[model samples]
Target chain A: MAEPCTRWDAEGRLATERGETLDAHFAACPDCLAARAADAALSARLVETGARWQPPGDWEARVFARIAREAPARRFSWWYALFPALAAAGLAVFFFAPRGGGGPGSPDPSGAGFEVQIGVVDGAQVVRSENPKPGDTLRLTARVPTRDPARVAIRIYRDDRTLIFACGGGEVPCSLADDAVRAEVLMTAPGAYRSIILTGAGPLPAPAGTLDADAAAARAAGASVTLGEAVRVW
Target chain B: MTPTEDNPTTPPRASSDPGAAEQAVLALLERDDRRGALTALMRLYGDAIYRHCYGTLLDADLAADVHQTVFVEAWRDLPRFSGRSSFKTWLFAIARHRCLDALKIGRRRRSRFTTDDDAPEPADPARDAETDLAARSMLPPLENCLGGLRAESRTAVLLRFQESMSYEDMGKLTGELAGSLQARVARAMPVLRKCLEAAGVSL
Candidate 1:
């Protein structure tokens, strides 16, 4: 039996670089040849008509202005070099700051001793810690590194799975929750933890250091913490 | 291979006629006269790019956006243009990528004004008939037939027939291998042809 002819159309082929194989087939196949002729007629008409359409007034100028204004800043910035230093300081403060009971690395006062810090991450921000244990609390403080003052979203993933997420929405200077930073979720089992702070809707993976420290600090800080069936902390 | 061992004696083919405009634009841009370059590009290929975009997008507003983006991106990346390919070809490549992306976005957003709905009203059937009576147009029937194709088919056809680019270039723009692209085009032609013939177009 002859092979069944597959359904094909001109638009898809036209979008392709090399001319369509269907065109070659059409050159021989009477049915396809007829269709190709009709398409050619319609294309010319559309092209002629489309050429007359004009853009809105001042659109080009506006686009030009926007491009000019944003172009230079999009280039490499000098502030990139100071990131590690700033991160060290933030991590030091987060590690050194008194926990829920007023002692450095103290577990949550009420809940399972988990404290999550949510805030803007500056270019210089970093998370730090030594060792982490279960029942211990982890405290995170983020400082987003953007001059625009837009709040970024913080999402934590443990062992490649989501754990907690917090963001200030549109509020300036970012936001923190009542007891924790923004929101907190417990990690029942933890091997390697990751927190990704996205600048926008798309997945902008936080730098490698951002999450390692948050998870490590959370584990180390929360060591020796007791858990209740239902406990509520800020 | 060393230049002496290779076909070094052969002369380079002159660049496409359209490349002169790009060269001129580059010269002006190099002098920091981006405005002049924009004007020159507009004058040289504005109508072609606009119409091509319109054909691909099927909406005037979207076409305009694509046009603006193409030029803006072109200007921004002009400094990085290495001149490895013909300028017009490069521009067309950019336009093709933008058109495909715009179409994808439009589809995801459930766009209504596709190329299928963008046919021009015949100003005068009698006059057009009279003009067609004398002028031997190559692809009128095919154009109307394109509207009936799936989005992918329509785009492929337009890029191939209207823009007249090589298969290799299409592969680069669409991220499809040559064999795959060829297979798709082969599969697409019959549907397009049948649609065209049904639209009262002569083979």
Candidate 2:
């Protein structure tokens, strides 16, 4: 018995491989050929007489403008609003609460001096410094929170320069002092320097998370306005 | 993320109507005034919407009302866009949904008696003078037969043949699986063929 003359028969296994055997079959079949021809004739006639349709003018700018207005506020606020509302609120309420024998007017120890926490995540240095600059020789001081010795790294960058260098991390395990971990480094010039204390807090922990609005703002807190500062700085 | 990412170019497209003016109107619409969206919609799709209504409902004036209603509904709902789909696709979905609703109501009102396939003779002299007048007239009857089909099959024919959408894009707009869409088209072909043949149109 003879097999049906299908597109697969004409084109070999390529049609089958691509999963286009149906299209191939329709293309090759005389029945489908006549049907398509009739369909084409009917369509052309209707189109010639039918009203034309097009997207409204200014559709692009309109759609984009709409997206632009919504995208910013929605994306940034997830962390921005959440952090200040929750973390900052908790901190505020804690600081405001009565402590020891003193009332609300009493001076707070945490408020008197700078508080810094440093850690290493996946071999990158993450530091919360009160007043750090590029040229300052930071002493390595750790109290107890430091863990994963090799995961800690200190990256220093000069102001107005793209050169980033690894000042510390490999052989020297960071030393703990009271509440801060210190690493000594010489900056080429005094400028704004960023120290990140990466903590593995997310589902997919990496060196650090993307700089969301809250994290960026937190990095700015208590950072020195001066290009360079003396010893005992956070 | 990008225009090309959403609207992949597969084939040459028909010259899009001047989109700048419609955009201007939309800007006004987005400004909390719907007059501009309405005016722009009428200018851009008034005729097309009317045709769509007529095609779907087979009534001229109701089609006109549907045309107006589409824009009004669009104006009311424009603020809800979330960018998950293109504005064009969203708008068409609305229009398609409305057409289907109107069709359901139309079916309830329509008698169950089926219409015969007898060809209506043209009374106009110019049409009579044409060498292929009968053939030309047969095309409209075939299209009218297409109109009698379920909404999806009718729309599939119009978008594929008239709008020149590829099956992939058609699937996206209609929310049909690509495999199923191909099968739908194949199934629809015989009905359309029979319609055209009954209308005395030669393939």
Candidate 3:
């Protein structure tokens, strides 16, 4: 039996390795000739129509303009109106709670003074807020004073489980940006949560159970740690 | 920290490499020039995205809506974009999800993808100006045959033929295995062949 004709069958030979000009085989095999012709024709048609479905000329301008006009998902919710109060409230409640070192004049081991800002994910834009609605994705963006490489992580303390964001894992996703070390934690449900940012020359220390415990652990991490900032989520 | 000096927005797209646009986008992003980055990105992937949305959704308004949503979502996620996947792949991933979401809502009646293949083609609908299908009384036979295909097969064929995407790239965009995409195109071919034959259209 002759080998079946396919594209690999080249120059009309069903099995060329046997070194036969199989022109007689192709002549006898009408199905093979028709199939081959049909395949080539189909391929040609596909190529011909490849450039057919061009998008409209104004598509780019119109789409970009629409993007410009429709704001990012910044509905701001009802809570945006309460930012000033929330900011002050955070300073009182969480700020004074307990901070170990790396303050304004504290031993500056990392050589960088950092400002940590927290916000809710509004579309791709992160709107700065210490108080984000329950279920809001919490974005962490911080500026370290030094140009040195600094690794940043976020540990959000919840009643059930303390979530940590450091390079990997979906629970708390963290990716170190070149200019800004950024992380985002999904605050799944409305609950009491205390979120803290941990930065270090090396890897950050894992949380030690509770928010306060984690804070103590961070402070103990010492010169190994870059900087720390905490936010209280109501 | 924002760059003290704005990095050059002019893209470093060397002529030789295929990934030049993506590189340009990354360069803009590295400079913290988001607006510039967006411009570069839109220029790179905008047409493919808009076409995918339109072809998948089959309605001008819904496709336009999804196209904008995908870009808006892409802009929002720019800070978080880790470049883990090729920018084109990642953006199409978003496009696919938004398309699914629109489908789930039964948005704009997907009858374009759903109407029976044997049934008469629904009166062709909407803006020829937006579609560039103006001044045509009816689509050519192949197009009508293409529209008659099952949605998945139609999408596979169109992406292969119209968008000129490889099976691997289509797999990444559609979340289907490359082999599955290959089989889809294969399955589509015979249906297309039969339809074309019935229409008395050669090739």
Candidate 4:
């Protein structure tokens, strides 16, 4: 008498990894044959179902229009005059400012003043301002002071406010005590990119959607810094 | 009815020489003729990409958004494409990620609302019926059955059967072990069969 086939045997049969034992079992076993037939029928149905879908005729045009509207900006060589002042202020805050006791309404208890600098990593040096090509890698470095180990979140967005990348949204939010935090972002296209840094006594909200909304949410949460920079690729 | 059923004049498969077409697009992109390259790329893979997106996302609007994002990201990242993988694979990877992101957003919204009543409604049935009538399609039952599936299972089934992908290719695209993917597909089949049966599908 042939032994009854197990589900694994049926799986083997489905995978076409049939052995003599399974072949003999299926030859004698009505149940196994039925199961195999059911599986095949299901697979066929799924394939047929998948084939039935057809995107609209103008789907390509719609896609093209969307990309046209949302695509990253092309390389722009004109440096924004405001960035130099902002960079200078950031440097001054990082270097000369005194650490006061945690201020009223400040999220950080250690009175850690936050500063973020966006730059392109040149060979062995971080350049504060440079026209990065499309494929260049940019570095975001932040100095955050914390009392206890705290959470830090960073979100980068394109000019259109679409999310580029986000960290600190999941189980392992970025942790920092009192040091500089750095993340590398690959430049995908030439665009005005914004980086928002959030550090708080608790988990920070993950940024989604446009830049204005993200900034507003981060500000509402009480501890965040937003920085914007432009890149050109040609 | 599928496109093959209704359309007597489907465009001949874009070209016999996909490699040549890909190369020409890449050349245009490299030369900064982004608009021209994009148009060419669209003509080459637009329908297939849209279908993949629609299958994965299960919503035409979301799929369209993901479709756009894939190309926008592709344009940005084209320079970084090492050509280690085929262009189709790379484009599909982007589409998958964008779809996943959209799913995450949808999940977040659903979770935040906290009530079943607050969940998004299905597409307007009247509009869908009109579209279906015009297209002479009968996929709504299948769509309903697919909607009943766990997202992972649905994705596995779509990638395997609809995309006609090998287990190895599916594993690469999904970042799962091939054996695990095989198991997932195996588990998904029975559930899908049951769902379809319950939905009164002949299968």
Best by DockQ: 4
Runs off by more than 4 Å, candidate 2:
A1-36, A52-234, B1-26, B30-33, B110-140, B166-169
Candidate 2 per-residue lDDT, tens place, B150-186, comes to 6687777666656565677667656576656655655
- Stretches of candidate 1 exceeding 4 Å from the true structure: A1-234, B1-16, B104-148, B196-203
Q: Give lDDT tens digits, candidate 2, residues A58-101.
A: 44344444445655554332111212222222321111111133
Q: Which regions in candidate 3 have their CA more than 4 angstroms from the true location? A: A1-28, A72-234, B1-8, B11-16, B104-138
Cα lDDT for residue B114, model 1? 24
**lDDT per model vs. reference:** 0.46, 0.43, 0.55, 0.58
TM-scores, chain B, all models: 0.63, 0.64, 0.72, 0.74
Q: Largest lDDT belongs to which candidate?
A: 4
Worst 10 residues of 3 chain A by lDDT: A91-100
Better of 1 and 4 by DockQ: 4
TM-score of chain A of each: 0.27, 0.25, 0.38, 0.43
Residue-level lDDT tens digits of model 1 in B1-203 = 22222222322223366556567767766777656666566556655676668666666678888887777766655555656665565566567657765764444233223232222112233544444333323334554455445556666656655666566766655556766766665565666555655766543
Number of the candidate with higher TM-score, 2 or 3: 3
Q: Which candidate number maximizes TM-score?
A: 4
Prediction 3 TM-score vs. true: 0.49
Model 3 clashing residue pairs (backbone): A124-B76, A199-A226, A200-A226
Residue A177 lDDT in model 4? 27
Question: Runs in model 4 with CA error above 4 Å?
Answer: A1-10, A17-22, A71-122, A125-138, A142-234, B1-24, B27-33, B115-139
lDDT string, candidate 4, A1-234, tens digits: 876556633364446521224446566667667667776787787677666666677655665566556544334312222234344554222211123344543234343455555556666676534335556666665554443323555677764356777655342333232455456777786455656555554555566476556654554565444344333221
Model 1 chain A weakest 10-residue run by lDDT: A225-234
TM-score per candidate, chains pooled: 0.45, 0.41, 0.49, 0.60
DockQ of each: 0.10, 0.06, 0.10, 0.22
